[model samples]
Target: MVLFVVAKEETLQKPMYLLLCILAVTEIGGTTCIMPKALCIFWFGFKGITVDGCLTQMFFLYLFAVTHSAVLVIMAFDRYVAICDPLRYTTILSNARIAKLGLVGLIQAVLLILPLSLLLRKLPLCANPVILHTYCEHIAVVKISLGDTRVNRMYGLVITVVNIGLHLTLIGLSYGLIIRAVLRISSKKAHQKALNTCTAHICVMLMSYTPFLFTALTQRFGQDNAAHVHILLANLHLLVPPMLNPIIYGIKTKELREKTAKDKDKGSNDKAELLSHTYSDPAGA
Candidate 1:
């Protein structure tokens, strides 16, 4: 619906909405990357993926995740400009620029994550490997690789920190600036409005990152934590945000909400008209 509405509604063809469309695409792709094989394991008899298959799946999984986070960081930048520098928001984040930023993010994800897959691909694996986790993660691949994995391990750690750390740092800075700007607004109504615009994004950012953070911390520090607990948290972080973002933005965004209402009304009218036509045509009835 986000993609559809953005494509159909000319009023929504702006930078923010375009980013939302990219996010929507990532959400769909991310879920698709993780769910099918998982469901197959649950429903059909459990089987395993081959080395190349795992690499491919790992590539897509990280690609979507890394890209999603990058886009969120970009969205934070959007919100910052809108709140902190409203006058120049249009000039700063032109549609073409946002598209380029999105492309850069995607290319960055590919460049950053492709090596991990390739690193794993080049390494030898056990004759019949089985990962403890439900999905094929990069670390899991490294864990199973039979060759010396010092480089893979170090590279993985560095990239994980760099990518996630950089994304978090930028998003935090953007929001901090946004808050300062909102606070500077004289009118209470304007302050509240600025804050309200940020509410959806704050919710989205928290939802997207909190579980993952908790899971990462638990895996790193919690010696007594259950394996299944980590697995569940990891999966939920991927699944829940994509499922909720559409609902969140739909309710919170004024233009999107108005568009949804209008679309609903239009649908109802069309249904009523079709019913009327069918009833009036006695032969058709």
Candidate 2:
């Protein structure tokens, strides 16, 4: 829905909305990587995944996750540009530039995760391997495998620190700068307006990252017997942002909200007209 609305709505073709569309795609991919199998396990108790399947799941899960983190940082940058330098926002965040950033983020995810996947592939599994959790998470899979996993654990730790830590730092810096810029505005209305623009973004970032970092830490350090707690945290990290981002954006953004309302009205009018015609002229095809 976000992608379609952004593509068709002329007013929503700005860099921010474009980023939202990319974020939406990442959310879809991230959820797709885990939701089906997790649900099947919970509902039908069918917990089966081959070695190849587990590797594939691990690759995609982190790929989308890393990509999602990058997008959040970029969105913070977007807000920074819009707030700190309104006059040059377009020149600074041109469509081509945003595309380049998205491409770089995807390449970064591949570079970081592909080697880890290869390392995971070399680990030996038992005759009947069972991940102590719902899905074949990278950490869970590594826990269940035999042989030295120090390299895999080290690589994952480095990736998490570099990817999640760096992104969080950058986002924090962007917001700090944004706050400074907002404060510099003299008029009361202007300050509030600038802050208002960032409200939805800050909320979304909190929703995206808090559970994510907690889940990552839990996967690495939590008690072995608390697998269920870890599983719930992981699902919340993967699932919540995607569910709420659209709602937050739609309610907070004037242009998107109005566009959706217009479309809804148009659809209702079309439906009513079709029904009226059918009732008035039943024999007419």
Top TM-score hit: 2
Top-lDDT structure, candidate number: 2
For each candidate, what TM-score against the reference? Answer: 0.94, 0.96
On residues 57-149, what C-alpha lDDT tens digit does candidate 2 reach at each position? 989989998998899999999999999988999999998899999999999999999999999999998778888777678888888788899
Worst 10 residues of 2 by lDDT: 219-228
Worst 10 residues of 1 by lDDT: 214-223
Clashes of 1: 0
Q: Which stretches of candidate 2 lie over 4 Å from their true place?
A: none
lDDT of 1 by residue, 66-178 (tens): 89999999999999999888899999999999999999999999999988888888898888887867788666667788999999888877877898899999998998898
- Give candidate 1's error at residue 220 in angstroms: 4.2
State the C-alpha lDDT per candidate: 0.87, 0.89
Model 1 segments more than 4 A misplaced: 220-224
